[model samples]
Target: MLLPRPLLTLAALVAALAAPSVMAIPGAVVTTPQVRAELVAHAPEGLGPGRPMALGLLIRHQPGWHTYWKNPGDSGLPTTFAWTLPEGASAGDIRWPTPRRLPVGPLMNFGYDGTLLLPVPLTVAEGFKGERLDVTLHAEWLVCKEVCIPESGDFALSLPREQATAGQAEAFAAAEAAKPVPATGAQARARIDGQAVVVEVKGLPADWQGAALDVLPATAGALRNAAVPQASWSGAVWTARLEIDPQHTESPPALDLVLVRDGVPAGLEINAPVSGSWPAPADAATPAEPAATPAAPPADTSLGLALALAFGGGLLLNLMPCVFPVLSLKVLGFAAHAHDRAKLLAGGLAYTAGVVVSFVALAGLLLALRAGGEQLGWGFQLQQPGVVAALAALFTLIGLNLAGVFEFGSVLPSSWAAARARHPLVDSLLTGVLAVAVASPCTAPFMGASLGVAVTLPAPQALTIFAALGLGMAAPYLLASAWPRLAGALPRPGVWMAHFKVLMAFPMFATVVWLVWVLGQQAGIDGAAALLALLVALAFAAWAFGSRSLGVRARTGFGLLSLALFGATLAWALPAWREAPPAATAAAAETGWQPWSAERVAQALAEGKPVFVDFTAAWCVTCQVNKRTTLAREEVLAEFRARGVVLLRADWTRRDAAITAELARLGRSGVPVYALYAPGGGAPRVLSEILSPAEVRAMLAELPAVAAPA
Candidate 1:
């Protein structure tokens, strides 16, 4: 029978006043001054013989330390309890109270800071209530602060069999009420715009601050503690742009968000939605869309302008360092066919068709992957080792071919060189394919905005944008092919053509070298060595094929050997794809240069230190040029140092998931992202992709005086 409220309250008061001593069970104390256990309770209050009673496992931690909850945020371990009860008795799960968020330098951990009461409910057997109830439990918990220590203990509780009064039940109920509650209506929706992971959360209270918010992963190895998440508040919504851990595997499981508002515990369980939709559909197309915006005149105008810009950007790409080599070759082909207008027109049209077809295929693949719930970005192709290795090999072979080391099929075997000179169409079509391939590495201006929109738009619209880009890229080549007079106006092919071709080979070789370097960054030194070996083998095979004395069999043998080498390399390199290491740039001491980390940047800004972050990639020629011509110069470094500027280098050489996410956080998807944190509290000053020395100096000069000496 349930006891009266007044009587239950009186019993609870007596128990509190008694302040019973906590005795350690046999083998319970693993370390000195700390007792660990599975169960603990007042002696006489235990269940009767053969009956189990509710028991509390009091984990009294060492001073300045504590244990953990099931979801250990940032750091710490959960306290596990294994029970061994007397015959006819059963034990219930432990009830855990809300934990406090512990900040250890750059990392955030969830754990108890002091003593904790873990109460476990026990079931008393029918007709077993008699004399005494004995229960045993084994428990383990991890305690930490800067460093971590794991501890374990065995504990037992004995209680008398009696009709438990209402007083005891009320006391236990109050303790249970203190347990931490999980956050409800917790949803994590993410949008991949450019290179950022803009994660939005709903059902959160207004004025949500970082201190009260903690992001926990529901699955193991989902989010890294080292990765910093920047939080912002807009009314009832809270958004956190977390640097997706590059080390984090793709398509991570659902994330658990623990929200503590003014110490009131709430929980949010969020899985990466299959697609970005409200009441997210199981078969949603993309992860999520950007927040809705009204259809304004500016929005339409901006999109039209973006399309125009994409066309212009595609045209400009033809002149880029990487694309120029193929363009020159195409020009040579056009010059040779200038006298034949029909052939010229056919060649141009064919080349344009190739460009459009390739672009359409790429767009289709990207969309298909998105439909299958994959997160992809503009330069996602470069993330694949096989792709990188193949491109490297192709460039090397092209270099050798252009240097007259080998020849393709020709009608006149006796005068193969003359035959090659006669057919400009072959070179023209190949050049078109080559241009698109090379242009993949360099993201031109206006391309990011367009591509970002394309990836999120319907398939047809996306393909149209892609086709427009292809048309722009093929425009110059098509013009030369369609108009013989224009082609004839150019210089005739001669020895200079050979020299130019040879010159172009160096650029191709340069591209190969850059790719190899990126491979090293992605797969580590061992992977890079393997790629290098593959390249050497390919070069040897080409040389063998070019040899005049080599028979068809011998040439085929060498070709097979090269293919085998590449296959072996791929076997080793593919699985080892990883983020590239941070860039190693020499900076003046005064600049207080440090490796780029989101936490460090936050701390620096909090401490009132101005920061300048250089987001660059080794494979980006523009980035390299900016580094050499501006940022790395002694004058610039010294000036930065003298002013106590904090220098942060965010390297995106290979496929860095974290840096990519960080870039996305800043509303960018590519490299050469520069942002300056100024003193006196203002938004960071964002610099353009192309930075001149004067531009860097001027930005520095405009900053306030250094608060601390370098």
Candidate 2:
């Protein structure tokens, strides 16, 4: 095809003017090296009846210039698509992919820089009239590199009415796959912390371990989008501190964030719900007080009955695995002076005092933290990686000392060691401390109600109950010493005592292993590894410091050097452990046990399914005991299945505010709070702390049967 010579110069003149433009029917296509704007039809199988069809709003931008997300941070306008679809067809929401943060001066913008497909689901109503569907899209966008320029164009596409072959569907499928799927385990909370708005999100995807949560509000002006978000992790929860836009007159109805896990380009994107306490802005003219926290549930049993339960629970605790390791220390104390009654009396008194003092201290701290806005309960200390690390080290040292790895050489002054050798009182006191610390995580039978009541009671009454618990715990050992016949029944203190102590050290070592695992759960594998390294360093320090062969001055020098190394290790480790991005929490997919959330619980209740919630913590020995013995057993699970029960494991291993709030609602404040929701909306049946498989089965079997969810 050759142009006439006369017209060729005319075309040349047109080319010289500027780049030529391409045109289409009922629409226009604008293309340049910097951007390409087009409307593409994604109807592979035409439109399904009463289903949504895909339509891609394709825009390709240059490296520097980019289009904006829904809430285009600051100083830019989002690309808009106004569509006129054929009769019986309408557009749904635009599904946006994860956004990038673009900076221009002091402003932060969220958008895409390269190719982006703003996909919309076009809902086609049933009984449509048209054979071929025609759509006209009027598009407008402000693309910016530094200076901003607004662009607009019209696009038209004809969608076929019938399903086509595979290639016709591939583009839409690819586009859909690239978008974020709905997020699971969704929870969010907002509050004012100083000048910033702090929003915390819990339970995204377990697979999104170490993922970054970048949130863009659905509302245009709810946030100062240009302000950078300061993110931090609290266990598996992600929190962002953002600068609130003072100019925005209203807060967002809800925090709807386009959650994007960093580096994950698959189905990890989601629009999820945020449910928790969202406090009003802190700078209100008349400051509003925070909502009052719910008190612990009222005591169902009489005070005398609760005390009896406490005593019985305390007695049974001696048999719990949590207390078994600690009892070894008491056994050592009992053996140290089996034949001498006066020293034994002094030892018992000191041990009892230690137990009572520890309980009082722990109760005070729990109350203080609760009052100070910390969502915490028993075993809360173990939830801290630092605390877990320290406890692990302590246990390891004790185990090593028992194993005769070293003596209390230069580390303890010679005079102090000499004094300890005579008294045996310090050993007894420490033994009691160990007992209570270990016991904190165990909610033996009657302990639950007593402790539950103690939390809500007046301070003095709570303290009295705690004191009673301490005395109960100390009773077995105290009674044995006070009654000479029980003490005398002990084997004669001799060579066997050495062997027994070494055997007991293994339990201490085992406890260390468990604590280290808990650290991994609280922090991450890296944190656990760091702690293990610290323990190794501590062992080396102890081995060097306890060297009797090294003289006092040399030992002292080695000790000081080791101490410096220890300090450095802690200083380097703790912050990193605290600051590292949280890994995905474990879910029991094999058993169909979902992570606990108030939303899930409410949903299950609304669905008319009987829900069983086990409020547990990783550090709670009693909770673990229940899990192994009853909750996870096949018999109990079958019963649950038969009864249409939804088993929800509310792990309070970390400080979860939702779980805490739920616990408060249940009138309890700790793990091992088992509640079974009625089929519909009804009061939940709070079960006993100590549950047997038979008991669980019996309880479920007793409920009036109903059809389970399909």
Candidate 3:
């Protein structure tokens, strides 16, 4: 049934030629799931040969979706209109309406929701012989909720010449009201100051004084879309400090700005000229707003409360899935030194120091990167594919080591073994580091609020909060080491210890499996396969070096072979990791859970359906636990179905700026956030990080009648 390439193309062309042509109508309408678009026009004075015509593409969006403006801002394509007309007729550019700020995730877009009108002017040349004035338009636009969809329409309109046809007068009147007006007597100038742009405007009407003005850039890429403008007034001149987008470095000759006050639609337009020389580029991007804005923690949140929450969250972290794999290692270390109080105490302190230092260092680096304008949040390291691959390799080695594939001291030369023996505390410290590495991906309950506040605070305070979290995580072990009685209670070292250690290797291997899956979520299946191959080669390398059955000479040769095999595998794997495609989205239909989008949530609510959104990540152990146990239970699903609730999953395995922004808007900065939305449009009820089947059922049962099927 397969057709050849040339025949298939010819068949498609023949099918198109057979299709019926749509006739031109005065007001042509097209409807899609997201928008209802109409081409409306007016010829005020009956179409004279040289008279101009006003045509508008008016779109009415579905409850939750919106289309882009002339300057889409940050991420979307602007709506475009291509015209087809007779030889003597010409169409001008679309006169855009004043756009409103639509904040999506972390990015800010300039667009319109509900209804949009884009007006275009058409001119007819002298001596037009055609009896009818015909206009054909091919238009394209990107409509967005949380997700964006590209849509286009082809429209044809005809108006009889010499007959004045009254058109959609109301729509044209509204379009005129929504358009931007000239700032009659205002004068403005702009200058670059470091990474910031300073705009000074003078001679505005005296009545407009003292009102807070919202400044929007008419030129795309001129300013950071999400950045809050800093403005102050002095006498007749008003100065506003705005962040210049680092991606677009060179300033435009003239910065076009829209100034709005009191949520007005029609705004004053100012074209400001750049008057100063540009400064040398900085080595790194810097924050335009060095001080925290009002979005940070409120004054009521004391430093003590933040530290307390951080410490408590860290203590609970030990029980999270990400940290469970490391516990066995710690248990083995404790068993080896149960009877030796001095060594046990030393190891514990070393581990605690390791944990604290690592936490502080990671927090400091994250803070630095964020100050430099990176839209990052908790568990940032795992967001990098390279980092995930490295972690995979690391865990594989540890698992192989614990499985007795490699003996550090006996596997190789004596010098290496002696060095390891001399540095027992170093091993303990490294174990602590590994523990933090895994634990970082899990955001325990109290940790979210504490860390959210920490990021906005001064460096010293932020670090202190991080230090407190580490101390809490290390506290249980620290306490056990300090108490000789607890060590006495532990079973004495025996031959059974060896078996227990081997059993512990399974958890380490499990950790490796989890890490590979996490990488797959970030870099697709190819990346995961690469990491697996690398781990297999590494296992063989460990085996070749440590297998005592082989003679010394044979072992040396195989060791060399192992090294070469691993090197070759690594070379192949590295490229896969670097060139990997973005995380693959799972098919939503199969799981009965739609991918989360702000628009989807809004639409569902608008339809009177209760919504439950699971803000989760593959790397978070707690998220997986709640998902498999409570949320996935038959009872929970039945209840959801009974209540007509829509399930949405916001996957945070990969770095999503939109998801990050949503978390921030929800007053948290990390995942395992559960939001239950009732039918009506109000704040969704946030659930605890951990969930229970009983609690879920109770919440569902409590839904108002509106959410239940009528």
Candidate 4:
């Protein structure tokens, strides 16, 4: 059979070309901005009917970022997997590894950094007779460092019907070793001891008895993640006292506890029976460790208390600058209907209905989004540039209407005008809607606490609280309308009323100005300028359509020209609205404050400097007021300089998940949140929603003096 080398090679090449095509792969890889994901599979034995296989989603994170675990502590979402398997195949849940404690600002969370593998066991039906196993995986995870980003990937893998030991054996082994095992020799139990849950385990291995152990609640929402528990060994039994999470209202029949010891690769898992029931909602403990976690208003706050607070907050919102403009418009409506009792009563009821219904709708949407793992809160709509732009345009039109630049009835088609006149209360209803839209950005005094609690409660209870807020807001007008004497005291509708209506238009213009500024903060100067141009074009269109002096043909031509101009401007401006704003150099320079990040704060603290963080948004009137009156004061700035304090502003004008998480950690869902972190590793002192110069001075005084270079 011996032959020349060239002849042999030619024969081999011809044979290879004649071979059948076969597609076999160990797995697939997919990449995103923050993670590299791989769908890897391994079968020690040959793939056959009813044979079990190990499949895993291997996630390799970029440096400084991490994804959440199955039970993401405090404020994060766990990774999820959706599989597409061959017919008659099934998969088990992911075998999660022991997660590390991640400290975010003042909060503690449990997650994996670097690389992690979520392994799942899969099995095919015994009757299967396929030549190969085809599978697909859809994976989603929230990756976070300074900010959180939701990322996902899809992958497919085809495995031939043979022994597939060729895949990542070492990776699979490591993941298997990382999974927690049952504590075979140990018996554990838990009981409520005042504000803490006391967990005790007996018959642990002698070597593990005296070692320092890291405890994690396998059951989510059972124990406070941020609260550090006290652990000790009493004789042969290990005991730990953990703070109970307020959300955990009922006593669990069994507690899934995970215990990790240093120098160990895997943890010990225990299903411990609970002895005592959780305390009543009103008796839940308020967090005492200011350094560990900001005192969160209890999530289990009584329904009546939460409702009352929401109502009070809504009533107080009427005084906030954000709601003042819309209330003024309502005033104009009140004066016009002062003489008609029946009409006033109907209008008030309609307005109340609008506000309540709108609030419930909004609450439902927020809850749904949150359940789907969105990091959002109250006033979330203003975070969208499109919403802000739309609001600005809407306000501009309202202002024009009030200023007599256009009459609704005269400008609209005859049928439309007739319908509006016949149902005049519709205007009142819409005005109520407008009031809520404007008022959303402002978190009134009691409102902050109530809303913070509402977001954590059940949907029905949360919606009820929101409804109470709406009713309170509509109460003032409701009262005035019901009491005919108050309306009787008003001057009759005349030239003076017209003058007042025109004057009230100024506030609407002011609101438009604010919205444009807020848009600038989110989308920068270019976007704001484009919006102004669009607004000018729109105003022109409105005027052309409303002009009575021009002949029909002339008016029609002018209107068409204006409409074309507006359409052109809108096309150019929309892209600008989506564009990210430039770096906030000007604001930082003006205020002598830097932008906030967890690393920056840690670095400042490491260098023995106090850090003050201002969690705020441009649309929040309360935040703007505090910025002007307290944060911008010369004395406060001088104090900051004197103490070597680092100032950081977390602008929440746009949607930022990191800031949202931080606010959640601070027991707040919306901002104007101020926290002053002193050097030397102590808890930060959180300031009130409304800050005063004296309070700022006093808080600044708490900073320890830094010694001069020795």
Best candidate (score: TM-score): 4
Q: How far is candidate 1 from the true structure (C-alpha RMSD, Å)?
A: 17.6
Q: Mind giving the per-residue lDDT tens digits that candidate 1 earns over 114-143?
A: 556777766766667445555667776766
Which structure is stronger by TM-score: 1 or 4? Answer: 4
10 residues in a row with least lDDT, candidate 3 = 285-294
Off by over 4 Å in 3: 1-108, 111-216, 219-269, 272-302, 410-416, 548-553, 578-584, 602-610, 642-644, 677-682, 706-710
Off by over 4 Å in 1: 1-298, 360-375, 410-430, 445-466, 491-504, 545-548, 552-592, 678-683, 707-710
**Candidate closer to the true structure by lDDT (higher is better), 2 or 4:** 4
* Over 4 Å off, model 2: 1-301, 418-423, 549-572, 579-583, 702-710
Q: What TM-score do all the candidates reach, one by one?
A: 0.57, 0.57, 0.62, 0.66
Which candidate, 1 or 4, would have the higher lDDT against the true structure? 4
User: Each candidate's lDDT (Cα)?
Assistant: 0.61, 0.69, 0.77, 0.79
lDDT, residue 117, model 1: 72
What digit string (tens of lDDT, one per residue) describes model 3 on residues 1-710? 11122333687667644533322453378787789998877777756655656787989999988887788876566888998888887878888888888876445778888988898877877867787777888888878876665567778777666666555767777887878888889899999888788999998878777789998888875688779999999988999998877545456878999988876668889999986765543332222211111245553565789999888988988887678889778999999999999999999999999999999999999889878866677887887877887887877777877788877555748987787789889988988898888898785555776777788788999899899999999999999998999999999999999898888888888888899998887667888888888888888877877776777898799889889988877776766665435322662643668887665665666566778888888787778889899987887887788778889888877776657656755656677888886654445677887788888887887875334446
What is candidate 3's TM-score against the reference? 0.62
Top-scoring candidate (lDDT): 4
Q: Please give, for residues 79-181, the per-residue lDDT of candidate 4 as tens digits.
A: 8899998887767899999888887744567899898989998787777677677888888787878656556666777666664543677888998898999
Name the runs in model 4 displaced over 4 angstroms. Answer: 1-60, 73-98, 101-109, 115-217, 221-252, 257-316, 334-377, 384-386, 400-416, 443-506, 520-611, 643-650, 654-669, 675-688, 702-710
